[model samples]
Structure formats: C-alpha cells, structure tokens
Target: MAGTHGIHVHGDVEGSQVVVGDHNVVINAALGSSVSVRSEGPPPTRRRTRPAGRALPDRAPQLLGRDRELAALERWLGQGYPVQVYGPPGTGKSVLLRRYAADAATSGRDVVYLPAAGVPAEDLVQELFHACYETENYKPEPARVRRLMGSVRALLVIDDFQGSTAELAELMDAAPGCDVLLATAERHTWDEGRALRLEGLQEEPALALFGEELRRPLRDEEYEAARRLVTAVRGHPLTLVQAAADTTFEVDEDARVTGLANGLSDAASVLLRLLDALSPLPLSAKLLPILAGGVDKAAITELTSLALIGSSGTGYRTTGRVAHLVAERTGPARDAAKLAPALTAWAAATTATRHDIAAEAPVVCHVLAAAAHARDHAAVCALARTTAPALARSLRWGAWHQVLDLGAAAARALGSAADEAYFRQEEEVRKRALGVVALATAGGALAAGGVIGHIAGTAGHGGAAAGKTGFAAAASNPAAITAAVAALVVGGVFAGLATAGDGQPRARPTPSGQVTSLAATGTRPPDPISTAPRPLTRPPSPSRTSPRPPTKATAPPSPTLITSSPPTDPGQGPVSCPLAGGTLTLGAPAGGEATDDYAWQAFKECDDERTLTVDKTDPDHAAFGVTPTSCPKTAHPGQYIPASGPCVYTVRFHPPQSAEPGTQYQAHVIMRDDWGRLSMKVSVYGTVSAASTAGPSSTGPVVTGAACVCSPVRMPRRTQRF
Candidate 1:
C-alpha cells in the first residue's frame, strides 16, 4: 500500500496499487513510481548536502530550430507537469534547461539550475541548499527544506541527470511546492510527465547554425558545399561547427570525422581510437572495464561530460568521426587487438544469467562484418556462434541467420566444403526451428526482447526447475528485470550505435539508409559518444542493474532546494544578469527623439572582458534600434578590460519620433574583444521608471535580463545548439 511518505511498490503481477496520494495511479503498474525504499533512520537532521561544480552559466545556447520545442515547453509548464527534455549528447539539453530556469526565476518562481553531467546527487543537493537559502554551510533539515518548498512555488532544472530517478522524485515530493524539469541523453519509457527528445537541427536550421559558426552568411558559391556538408553529417550541430573550418567541405563521413577530431587530448585520442572498434553498437557500461582496459575512469568521465563519449551512464558507442581519426594512428597500444577477447568474454558472461543475451547479439554480427579490417576474423566467427543462443531467445532470427551465414563463409574461406555444407544445414535447422519473424513492429520488438528468456525464467521460477536455472534465480539483484537490448536494437534506438565493419553508422536489420528514431516505442537517431568501460562513480546506475519505470514523486517527500528571490516591490520584478558572451541580445527601446546618455556602468562586468570594441549595431526597430537610448555595446575605443571592468562606452540613442513614454527599447550588442575568442552579446535597454503609486522612483531595467526580462536567457529570437 502506498502511503504519505511515498514508500510503495507497484507489483505488475499482482492486483491494483492502492495509491493514497495526490497522484492518479494506473493498474498493473506504478504509473507514478517504481520500487521505493523508505529511509530507515531517525528524524531528519540538519546535515548540509555538499555542493559541487560551478554555478549555472549566465547565458544559454542559442535556441536553433526549436520553435515547436519552445511552445511545447511553455504549454507543459502551464499545465504543471514535470518536463523531461532528452536527446543525445550535444543536442543542447543543458542550454534549454538553463533558459527554462532563468525564465522561471524572472517570473518570480524560485529557480535552481544544475548541470549534472558528471556530478553526484549529494553534490547537487549541496548546490541546491547553497542556491536556495543563499547559504553554503546550512544543513537542510527535512522540515526546514519542506517549509521553503511548500511555502513557495519553485522549479529545479537538473540538466543531464545521471542520478537515481526515484531519488529525484523523492527530493521533489519532500519539497512540496517545487517542480522539476530534467534533461538526459539516455533512453527510457516515461509513463508520466512530458518527454521532449531533441533531435539534430533540421536542414535550414543546420545551415543557419553553420553560418553562425562561420559568423557570416554562406556565400552563393559556398552554399552548395555547405548543404552537402550539412547533409553528410546529418545536421549534427557540433559536427557542423567543427566542419565549418574545413574550407573544402568534403561530402564524405570520414572527412567530417577528420574535421571533428581536429583537437583532442592524448587520453581522449587513445580512448576514441580503442572505442572505434566497438562502433555502430553501444556497449553497456558494465563492459567498460573489459573494453577500455587500463584507460583511467577519470578520462572516461571527462570525455563523457564533454559529450565526446556516451551520454553519461548510458554505455558507450563509437562515432564514425573517431574511426577516421584513430585510423590515422599506428599505435604502439592496439585497442583493436583487445576488442575480440572483450566481446567473447562479455558474451560468455551472459551465458551464466541467460538474460538479455541478445543485448550484444546484433553487436556481435556487426563486429564480424569488420573481420578483415579488424585483423581478428577467427575470434569474431567464434563470437557470432557464442552469442547464438542470445540471438534466438531474444527473437533475433535474422541475426541468428547472419551468425550461421558468417560461419559458413568462414568455412568456405578455409576451403572446407564439408564444414560449409554442415554450417548451411545447421542454419536451415535453426531457421526451421525459429520459423519466420517472431514479431514485428516496435512494440513487438520490445516485448520479444525477453520472450524466450522469460519463458525459461518462468519455467525455472514456477515450473519443475523453480529457483534454479531461470534468469531471475541466477541474477544477483533479485527484484530486477533485464530490459531488451534486442528490442532497442530492432526498433532502431540503437540502429547505428555500432558502426558496420567499415566504420560508419549502420542502420541495423538492414545495413543501409539514414538512421531514424523508432516509429513506435523507440529512441533517438544515430548520435554516438563513448568512453572506455569505466567504473560508475555516481548513482542512477545503468538500466541493466536497476530498470526503474517512470513515475511522479509520491507524497510528503521533502528534500531541499537552494535559492529563491526575496520579496520584491509590486510590479518591480527581479532583474536578470546580462546574457553570457557571444550571442545577440534583444532590446525594446522606448522614448521620443530623445538623446539621453544613460551611464553604461551596468554592463561593466557583464562578461569576460579584456578590450571591447563595437562590431556593429543593427537595430531590430531602428538605429541604436531600441526605442530609447541604446545599451552600451563597447567601451571608449582602446583600454585593457579585466574580469571586473568599468568598461564604458558613450552611445547616441536616436529614438524614433513616435517613441512612447514608458516603452522598453531592446538593444542587442555584439561586444567584440581583442582576445582570440568569440564576441559576447549583452542586450541593453534604457528604462524610464514611472512613479509606483506614490513612490518616488522604482527599480527599472539594468545590466541584467530579468528586470531586463533577462537577456540571452529569454525565449529569445533563437539560440545556438551544440
């Protein structure tokens, strides 16, 4: 029975769950929860959760090609649902979450944005306390945390969450009036809340972002090359940015890979080279130790955090880009040599559990395809046969056939006609036994992931072999169930996670065409990242060990939040800080043909500064485009600017003759610095405060965006993604 504290279990094999809370429950599932373990300690203490990493960035990535996404986020926000923005690494999840948090903060809702790529939950909680109460040392006692959470509305934007989903829900429930919007790169079924999977930017947006990378529009002659380049890399933002510098703009995947891998650390370079052998298939983190060999876990995590590897804790997959770069090396340390044994060892280990053997089934076949290139055909042949049981039980009749076909070819290569005929006959026997496709459609693929294994497990569970050979009995975690790697493989969630033998993203089931998301219950397109199989240093372990379903936090579960805005005068909202450097800012200038010289001190320390110069002032509305005086874009011609600078610039604001008395004119500045770095944008607007009832004067637009509606953080005309 589910109670006030949210400690309940939703047993699928049993009767209905009695949810005695605010959430609506569904039958046969915990629709709102998973296996929850209540804290067994005494009354909560005032123990502070230690904070980690840096605070939220002042700016957000440009929101490129996300109008529909913006509308979806706002609509979901209004309805009060937990929002999940998911996509592969580098799809700009962090940027979106930061924007959401900044907006909420501007609207007077307490906001805490945490970028959790490699951060632990405890560290995040520490960040929460420090951000919320504006105190770093205070221990967050349950009741105290509860008061702040319930007394006011709040939002927690956890970007790239790698912690426990249940734990996250618990923290939210504990904090009564708080809501959460988490972004992740892994794939999971979320039965509740709203899930938005951010894909690669569409064609136009891709080109637009590429131009932005170039900091100029594509030339007419260069347009076709850019188009072919964009299409060649499938509109992946980061790839485009890296490729922009390659003037030749080759229309080849290998060329794009070479370009993207231009500058990488030696450790990263080594890991990528080794991991390339595992391409086209995402290997589970559990197998990292074997695959990565002696590669340090820190390097793996660093790469993961940088999106050069897996999307954090979701296992690792090699991108074709890594393949080309690694291919250039004649390494003394050969990672490819280690590939065969690792696959074989992992395959052998699965035999003990007989669960999700198909997890690595497709991967085995794909690896075999690279036998000649891999310099290890003999082992690959063995690998295919070794995982045969997994292939059949997981309903990979096609893979099973491929395995036999590979074996027959191996025999033929050895000039053994008898062995080849024997292999062919065995293939026919298997085909006859498994018959045609065991299932079709995405849903069927997921279900068939464990069809045969489940049957065997059931037999060992309730039949004559109860508690013996079945997966559940053999599994170390008694309550856990293996999710279908085969199912995902079939539906294209992992279609190109592993590349074909030739080192390119391969559409599985059929090694052709551009990879796409599951048309049904599926995953994202072919976006790959990886690290050596490194040991997990944080919670929210991979789905293999604990496959928790999606659900809302149960009731009365208070944890803690860090920051909130103090009371503000009515109509005088909190002011936002200036947007981060290197983007455009909008200003709605207001005033009549007034030539007012407002002090530009507000933007003194807005961004990284050394020496500032005005690049260009193109007003959306007019010259100095803002309605009134323009926000300062640059300091007086020449001066060294420091981190905290009193960089000042005098600008003439030619407000249109029809300017209004209290209109807020928006000004976008492309602030260029002498340093070899991208320019920063600060949206500055002039504001003439009106009397607040009987008050003398009121707080108005400043260097910040909030009171300024907060620069760069706004829904924005558009943002960059990558």
Candidate 2:
C-alpha cells in the first residue's frame, strides 16, 4: 500500500490476497506482494478550474512601513524564539508577520500562517498541530505531530492572536523549540515571549500608501486634507487605506476639486463604529462625551474596553465612524446632544473628586448644555481657594493666580455677604503670615550687622521696606520696639566716645611768654596768649646793625637794637621765655633719651610785649619736662612738636605720661610698628594761639599776623627721587 502510487481497493486486504469482486479479476495471491485489480468506486467530483485569463488570488507582500519589525521577526525566526507583536489596531501587525513569513518561505524556509481570530481554541490547536507534522501530502498522527514540532526548522505565524484561549497554551508549550510569530491588537498574557509594540504609520508612509493605491498625485489641498485626516485618526493604516480609497481630488476649469476631502468629523464617525464593535463593553450613548473629553492613551484604553474609542500610537483620537453612525441614525447633532445632560450630570456629581473639572467643563459644556446648567459652586470654590494655595506653595504662581481669580469669582457668585466677610477675615491671616516673614528678616539682620545698612538706609532715607506691609507692621510692634532699644545700646557701646563740643569751632591758646609784632618783616603774626591759641612762626634772620660807633669828641647816643634769637631751653625743668623769631624750631639731641613728661600751660604775660608764657608747673607737667636739652646718643622720649611759632614757656620736671593720657600736663605719644610692636616715641609738641598783630602797630610787639602767615604751612611738593 505504501509503494503503490495509483490504485483503488474496495475491501480490506490481508497478506497479499488479490480479490476481485463484481466487475474485476484477481491475480497473484501471495509472495507478500500482489498486483490487485479491483472495480473502482464512482469517480470523485472534480473541482472546477478557473478560465485561462483568471488566476488564483495572489497575496503579494503586504508589509508597509514595517522594515524594522520584519528584521526583528527574522531574528526571532532564526533563533526559534516566539515573538509577539502588539499595538493598537491598524498598526499592521498581521501584515508585517505575514510578509515576514512569505519572505522566509521564498528564502527556502517553511512557514505556516494561521488566523486565530474567531477560531475555536481546539480547532486552532488542531490546525497548528497539522501544520507542524503534515507536509507534501503526508498525513501525520499525534506522535508524529509531537516529533515534528521538536525537529522542524520552520516558523508559524499567528495573526489576530488576542482571541487565543488557554487551550492554545498546550500547542504553545508543545512547540517550545519551534519559532512562533504572533500578531495581536493588544499585548498578550503569554509568558514565554517578548512583545514589540508597533506604532502607526507616519505621514510620509501614509502619503506613499495613498499615492500608490490611488494611482494619482493628490492635489495640494487634498494632500493637506489627507494629512489632517490621517493625523486626527493617528495615521491608522486601516483608516488611511479606507480614506485614500474613498477620497478623490480633481482640478476643474477653475482649478478646484468639485468637493473637498471630508472633514475630520466625518471620518471620525466611521472609525468610531469600528472601534465600538472591537470594544469589550458595549458603549452606551451616555459615555461618549466623557471619552471624548480627551482621547489620551489612558482614556482610549479605558474607552476601548467600553466600546467607545480606539487608537494607534500616533495618539488616541475620536473616530469618524461612530460619529457618522450616530448622525445617520440619530440626527448627528441630536445624538451628540444626548451625551450633554449625562456628562454634565456626571461632572456635577463628580466635581468634588475631579481635580481636572475646571479644564474639562468648558469643552464639555459646549457640546452639552447640561454642563453649563449644572451648579458646581462648591467645586469651583474648592479649586479656587484650596488648590490655589497649594499651587502657589508649589511655585506655580501664574496658575495659582488664575485659580484664585476663578475661585474668587465663584465664591462671589455662590457665597453670601457672610462669605465675603469670611474672606476678608482670611486676608488678616494672610497679613499675619506676611508679618512672620518680616520678623524672620529682622532676626537675620540682628544676627548679622550687614543687614543694618539696609535697615538704616530704609528708615533714615525713607525708602520702602523690603518685606510686605504686614511684615513691616510686625517689625514695628511693641516687641520690636524693645529690640530696637537693645540694638541702640549695643551700637552705642561699639561706636566709641563722642565729645559734645569737640567738633565746634573755638579759640585756641597761645604759648606763654611769646612776643609777636605786626611790624616784623615777612608775614604778620597772631596772638600767642589764649589757652587754645594758634601762633605763627617765621624763618630765623640776623639782626641788622651799624658796624661802628663814633668815639672821638662826642659820646654817641646809646644804640638800642631789637635782637631776635632761638628760645632757650631751661634744662630738665620747665622753662619760660619770650619768642624773638616768628618761627621757632626746637632741636632735640639726635638720640637723646628722656623720661620728662610735659604739657604746655599758656598764661597772659606782659601785655605790651604781647607775650604769653608756657609753664610745666604741676607734677604732671614736671613729668613731661625731662627731655635732654643737648643732643644725645640714645633715643629721647617723644615730644609734642608744636607748629612753628614764637611762644613763652615755664619749665617743670615730670615722668612721661603713659599712652592714651587725656588732660595730662605731660606728653603722651605711642607709635606702633607694622608688626604691631611698640616703637620709641619721637619728639612732639603742642601749638598755642596768639593775638592778632595785623592792625596799626603799638609800642610793644603786635601779636596776630595776617591770615596766610598765621595759617598752617602748605606741604611742599616732593620730587620723585628715583
């Protein structure tokens, strides 16, 4: 039986029996082989063949915009790994899988394509098993099916596999080593596979598809309309294919298509109905508006299960199919309106929980009057007041302000005067909040004196405060007043001693025993008598005198000469003397060391001589008077070097005053080194004022000098020696 190519048998044959029944003959019987002639049953009915011109439906490579997906399928096929392709409908998952399978078959690889959609689970398993074992007109048993699956180097493509049930799991488990490609409208629950999500075709691909299928170039306007339609439909291949087939553009004599491509609304309706049929739940007329609120991924997935929406990866959108069906049967506008009251009621009831109500209501209300008519005062107010603060705190200032305005308006409309009063009271709370901020700022200022400049500049210069009024007001509170007093005390302690009359202009004393004359050559001089006097001094000059005196017969009148010389130093004791020159330069020994502490005490001397006296009478003055009269080799105590001036003086002996001595008759001078070490004192002296000698000269020396002469000398411009 296995060797015979063409023969018929009517009865069961045992061994090699050749049996002829009614219209036949029997031949050789044994030999384990026999040539049997048997009457054949009536010829089987033949299938009618197509005419010469007709051919079998040729399924060409259908893949579009799926090159990457095909490559992935090839990789999985090579590895004998099962792969599941998933995405929203119209992404061409099935087409891609089938095309890959065809390509593999053309490359000498065996492939079996199965459509799982609507097929019974048992039947699908059976068909898969048959494809695995049977080949080239051979029948396969269950054992052969199992063995074939283990060894076969072929791929199986399952299209629309989302409908597969648990029964199909056995077939999957049996073909663990065999390659399987699954195409589904949604991701599957299969455990032993990787899922590749497919995105919708892009605009360029869609346009190419349109051009290829339509066999004509789309006009500019038609192309634009197509693009809009495709984008709105998320470039869904199925929808684009339908739209491309249905739409046509032609240029008339006026260069316009007779009718423009349909609007999105029209196309959306058709897609909508298809989606409805594919949905898990029967979408009632009630839920359409809610789904349309925003056709995002989450919304689409939700509505898809409810039979109200569909989407592709370009993004979820309303369907023209559903829109049109409703329009054709239930008056487009009227059917759409039916959703209004229900959506409005839903919105109103759910407003308290829906954070997005404000954003959604306006659009929903446009389609459904009930949305506008529904009262949501509480919701609006809650959004405005509570949410606004949260937004502000989150630093969404613009959004916070918008929400506040919205809430304020809602509150005004829905709330009574009492509500307004409550808000006004809340304003006080806000002010108090501002006060807290101000207090914090103040505390910072107190911690760091740098903020003092800002505060003083504001208060003293009358600039506006940095913080809000409440903060400023809080800073001005009684607590702040005490703080201010404490700060003032602290500042005063740091500022040092401030003398009351120190900055005032007053008369200065002159050196004691100082004689000044307005008639003296050079600049006129000032009085040197007052306690705080200011005196002027001049350069030394030799006295003018005649060289001879007549002596022969008559006695020459006694010559009287006014002689001027440097003041005399009276040893270690304070000395008093009249000044001759307008200037006096006290020269101390180069390195003379003295412990003499001295302070000048000016007193009115002879008035006619316009003389004043400086005496170191007290112990303090004596202590300051011990400077060496002659130059010495050692360092001398510092002296008060008075401005160049003629002055009278009284000398006394005392120890040098310590540093920071005030009102001590002795001099106190301290010098610091760059390294902060103390250095030996240099000679220094105090100045004294004298009476003016600018007017008509009197008998005695006129005192005060001209302003320029009495004033302190202008420092000379020193040349740069380098």
Candidate 3:
C-alpha cells in the first residue's frame, strides 16, 4: 500500500499554524485563496498553553504580604528604573508581574507582556516586536524592534525569564523606549536595571494570606496553628494557600508534596530525589544535569514549573519542607549510586577562588554531604582523596577538615583496614600542616592572636581538639605557650615540651637520634613509637627583651606526640549497601573464597622505618590472610594484593561455608602495618540466589558490592623506594 501525505507551504498561515493530515493530499485550491496540503505522522503532542496576558481585577488577588516590596517596586517603576524581580519557585514572581502589567494597562499606557521562559531568544524578540507594533506577524530584526518600541509609550513585561544576563540586556536594549520589567527564578544585576530579591512573607502577612485563602477570619487558636504552618513552609504564599485550602491551614506535609508532584514528569520526579539529597548545599540549574546523572534539561524545566525547587541569587535550593518530602521518598542506595560519580568528577576538577569556582561550592558541599549521609564510604573517600591537595592549596581548612572527618567516618564504617589507615595518614598530614603553622608562629615570637586557632577550631570542628595537645591546647593558652615557644625558637633553641599551668613539666621522650633540648636531662627517653596522643602544656612567658638560649645542662624534655585513638566500634553495617557496579562491590564472590579488587593503592611512603607487616595474631589478619605473604605478588589468596607503590588492595573473601541458596554473607578485610596504624575494614556483601531449576551455573541477581576505594593514589614526594 502506497501512502501519500499533504504538506502546506501556505504564505497566508496566521501566527504559528499547524498543518496535519495523512495519505489524502487532495489539495483544495482556489484563485486568490489557500491550498491545503496534508502531512503524515503521529498525533501532535499536547502543547503548553500560553500564559494569558490578562488584565488585573478591580480588586486585586489578596496580596497579604509583599506590601513593602510592592511599594518599592511601584516607586522604582514610577521613577522609570527598569527592575528585575527574582525569587525561588512558587514565590509569586509571575503573579506580581501580572498585577504590575494590569496596573500599567489601567493607566492607559501601552502594555506588552510575554512569558519569556521556554521560548527561544529570537522568538522572544519577535514576540516583543509583534506586541510593540500591535501586529500578529513581523520580522524580529533588532533595528525594527527598536523602532517599534521607540514609537510607543509602553510598559514591557517579560515574565518567567531564564537565561544569561546578556540575553536580558539584549531584550532591554531592543525595547529602549519602554519601562522593562523581568521576573525570573535566577539573579541578574542589569547595568541599566535594578534587581529585587523576593523573600517569603512576614509572619502577620503570611497568616493573613492563609486566612484570606480559607475565606474566613481565624480564631486565636486557629491563628496559632496557622502560624506554625506558615513557619514550617518558610512563609511561602503558595504553600500557605494550598495548606489553607486542603488541610485548613493545619499543614499536611505529605499532602503538600503529593500536590506538588501532581502532573510532574517521571524525569522530574527522579530529579526531586537528587535535589533533596543535595538540599544541604546550594543547587543551580546549570548543575542539575551533572548532579541528576545526566537528566535532560527539559526535566529541570518541568521541576521549575512544579515549584519543587527554588532559586537564590546564584543557585537553587529545595525548601526544607520539600527536602523533607524528597528525603522520605528517596532511597539511600539510589542517591549514593547516582551521586558518587558526579562527586568524584567535581572534586577532581581544578577550581579557583574566582567567581566561577566560588559558585561551585554549594554543589561540592552537597555532593560530599549527600554521600556521607548515604553512607557511601567509597564515594566519600574518593572525594576526599582527590580534593585534599586542592583544599590544602586553597587553604579551605574548614572544608578540608570536613572531607577528612567524613572520609575517616566512612573508612571506619566500611571496616576496611587499609582504608582506615589511609584516612589516618591524611589526617596526620592535616594535623602537621595546622600544627606547623601554630608552632612556627609561636617559635618566631610573633603576635599569635587567638583568632588563628580560635577561628580554625571554631570553623573546622567545634573546638573538637581544644582539650588536648593539638589545636585545642594551642588555642587555649596561645599567648603563654605560643609566645614562649616563639621566643625560644627565635633564640635558636629547638626541642622541648611546654610546661603545664600548674608548673609541672608534661613531657614525653623524643625520637631516636633527635635532640630534645639544648640542655640534656640524662633521663632515658620513653618508647619512641607510641602513636597515642599525649597531653601538651603551656610554657612560661619569657621577657621580651631578655631572651636566652638554654644550656646543655638542662633536664631532659618531652616532645609532644599529637595523635587520636583509632575507632573502637568499626561502625554498624554501612548505611546502605552499594548496588552492583558501584564502588565497594566486587562481583558476586565465586563460592566462599571470592576476591574483590580495589581502585586505589593501600600504601603510603613515610619516613618511619617500621616495615609493613600483617599481624597474624590479629583476628582480622588471620581471617583474611594477606596474599603471597609478601609485597608485589599477584593472584594469591583473596582478591587483594599490595603493589609496589600506593595501590588499591584487592580482597578475597573466604566465607566459613558456602553453597547455600537464598543466603547473604559479609566479606570483611582488615590489614595493619607494624607501626600500629590500622587499615579501614572493608566489607563486601553478596547473596546466594535460590537454586535455579534450570542449569547449575544459572543464578538469580547475585548480590554484589564493590569494596574498591574509587580514588587514584598519589605517592608522596621525597620518599625512598623500598
């Protein structure tokens, strides 16, 4: 069967006409008339209705809040200052624009309004041209647009704008003769216009809005409940109205979320989970695809329409209420798997303190935080390992500490011996960096203000180490100890522990062959290799002008050894198990002795002479024997093998007994070196499927967890290869 279709090239077609027909192109042609042609395809998808540029009512919709903003806007527009009003979704940007446009129309001025969002730039220009000229059809030439706009005294309202500043600037430039107003979910500071950031309603007005929507005056008790509802939704007007209509202003959060979810596309629904997971950090439309695992941009647009998320000056944020809803609906496993790769990429990217880089802080923080919350240890450690150097270089001490803390927690949670040790090494590096600065400043006899340590401790970790010998001790009596140490170091006096407030010398022996003090105490040094942190004391304040170096006859001094205790509770099973293909999962173990590979090396090049040794006496070591009983050997017992440089260790799981159908097992790996540093325990999980009735090799979804730490290992500089 041959199919024929009709197509129309009608010059007389009005504004944006659609021609639809199939297989029967019987062209109806008449002189000085139209010829209809048909085309064949599926039915046209439903198109979004254009927003009506309707006139405002004589009595405007009860705008209970926004009085101040409304007054300010009127004054600005009256004074002829072009204004751009922006806020998060459902904050009533479009409603305000409509009211303003209606007011302009009532004043007898020509009014041109266009819903600019979801429309192309060229199409927007054309719409503007048509509105300005009072014509349905026109070419969108910039010169013609300017000419049409200049000939009329008009108010131009471009609502729901989404684009760069330059695009808005271009629109403003074209409509030179009119007062232009833009409403958007983004922030733009136009050179020729003012930007007004809209926030939620005030308390009284928010309550008033609720009452008005409910069509009744509230009693005192109802008013209190309404106030609670308003506060819960952060005074967003739309939410209050919906609550008033549906729940009588009592505020049903679940109902509210479901209402918002109504009419949302599937992609938008999935994005809600990602946005909720990242609610802890600032989000932007630009980062939507990256964070949502490459969702289409149209889905983001739909999310905006649904008002599931809102925007600030530079980025987006899901409201606390919406975030809660999303959190309840989303699974931790889904979030971890989706966000792990994106976070890894984000941490690895080179960034700066410049404007562009600064804008990315929210996304970065959100990824790390979400991964941590999801108990995605592999993702957290991956981010930490990659971003450590950059964080150090940028001096983002607080962020660096956050990474370290999260990484350490994840390592501990995973029960990966090597992973835990890796985090400890990183922590040591951080401690050294912080301690060196404090110690060097004190030694230099410089003015060590409390702000340095105080701010670092406050911002980094709530003064977590304040009680001990590291930053906390330094911050506690910075003046006496730091000042005295600086005086001594300035006088070329090197090693000695500080004195306590009670005047007792709190000390520990220094390492071998290292001079503790210029003066020798003749006392035998303590054990040189205890990794435990020892208490430090404050030193006596020295006279400013009378600094003297200590002689060789002084008593032996204790060198400070700052360290923290290894975790005791290896941590409950990771918050969520990695799905197949995510980090921390090796494919289903082949029987009881399955081997799992890792992505990063487990070695660190350090100055310590202690050799890496498997403590066979340790239960973990005995359970998962090291492969080949030596370094540089491959294909030994379990999946893990140690390489020459720092490389990820593979683990081989040896279940006590296997071959059981419909059972799950945990593979635990714990390794340690002779220096007392313990590796994070790595746990890989797998399940034995029910025996298939068919073939012996056939199995159900073999549960798999990749125990690999997905980070590239970088060897430390200046290390001697063994």
Per lDDT, the best of the predicted structures is 3
Model 3 alpha-carbon miss at residue 624, Å: 78
lDDT of 2 by residue, 632-691 (tens): 111121111111111222222222323222211222222211112111111223221122
Query: What's the distance in Å from true for residue 624, model 1?
Result: 65
lDDT of 1 at 451: 23
Clashes of each: 57, 90, 38
* Candidates sorted by lDDT, best first: 3, 1, 2
Top candidate when judged by TM-score against the true structure = 1
Q: Whose TM-score is higher: candidate 2's or candidate 3's?
A: 3
* Cα-based TM-score, every candidate: 0.35, 0.28, 0.32
Model 3 is weakest, by summed lDDT over 10 consecutive residues, at 711-720
Better of 2 and 3 by lDDT: 3
Model 2 lDDT, residue 461, Cα: 21
Across 431-538, the per-residue lDDT of candidate 1 in tens digits comes to 322221111112222222222222333322242132123423323332232233232222311121122122222221231112222111101111110110111111
